[model samples]
Target: MCFLFLFSLPIDTSDRQKSLPYGTDPEYFKMPTRQHLQASSSSKVNTSAKYHEKDDISSDIDNELSVIFRTLQDLRNLKENSTVSPRTEQKSASEKLLKITELQAAIGDLKRRNAKQRIVKMPQKQN
Candidate 1:
């Protein structure tokens, strides 16, 4: 039984020396150098700046939407309260409504574009 067990053991011991620490690959334990750290930090800053810019743009869009909503409410009130109006006033109100609707559509398109850009900018994780 002792002889059989001894025979079952690996005969070659050279492979042991080549084996990495903790039985894993060396690349997994790679240490980041100064240049790599610096580069990564700089990229983080750039990413942060981009995020801030996006936030600013988003806030601006929100503000514009709020203003447009208020204007629409006021227009509705005007249309409801006034029983009679001149032809020019009615035409102008219709034009304002059309312009506001167009602006809303444009803002919607911008929001979609920004969302797409955000998705594209996100990094994929490696297994």
Candidate 2:
């Protein structure tokens, strides 16, 4: 009975632990040294800053956005102040109009091709 009682008690770490061992758990050591997280009456810094602080965007991100904005402005200026002769503009416009007309004609041709047609055929099997 004494031998059974002595042997029944846990001998080593693996025999004792179910999920975690005796020394492996952080809470065991932390509980003794840890102070209460309750807010103090005269705290200088915010306590929430310890856990839930918002991350600041790096200066590199700001610089990248400024560069992208400058590039967009430059492209807008180029589009607004296009340098082309009046004759050249007229020629391009006429070419675009000709292309549009060709597209419209092609659409009409497709519509004609797709027009429904009736077909006469023998009756299907009666069975």
| Top candidate (lDDT) | 1
Total colliding residue pairs, candidate 2: 0
Q: Give the per-residue lDDT digits (tens) of candidate 1, residues 11-82.
A: 787886577677687777779999999999999999999986875553455767687677778766764436
Against the true structure, whose TM-score is highest?
A: 1
Assess candidate 1 and give its TM-score to the true structure.
Answer: 0.36
Please list the C-alpha lDDT of all candidates, in the order they appear: 0.76, 0.52
Which residues of candidate 2, in runs, are more than 4 Å off? 1-81, 116-127
Please, what are the lDDT tens digits per residue for candidate 2 over residues 1-127?
9999998997777744455554676576454422354335224356556432432212344454465566546544544226988887787668656755765665564444334211113456697
Candidate 1: lDDT of 31?
90
Report the Cα lDDT for residue 94, model 1: 89
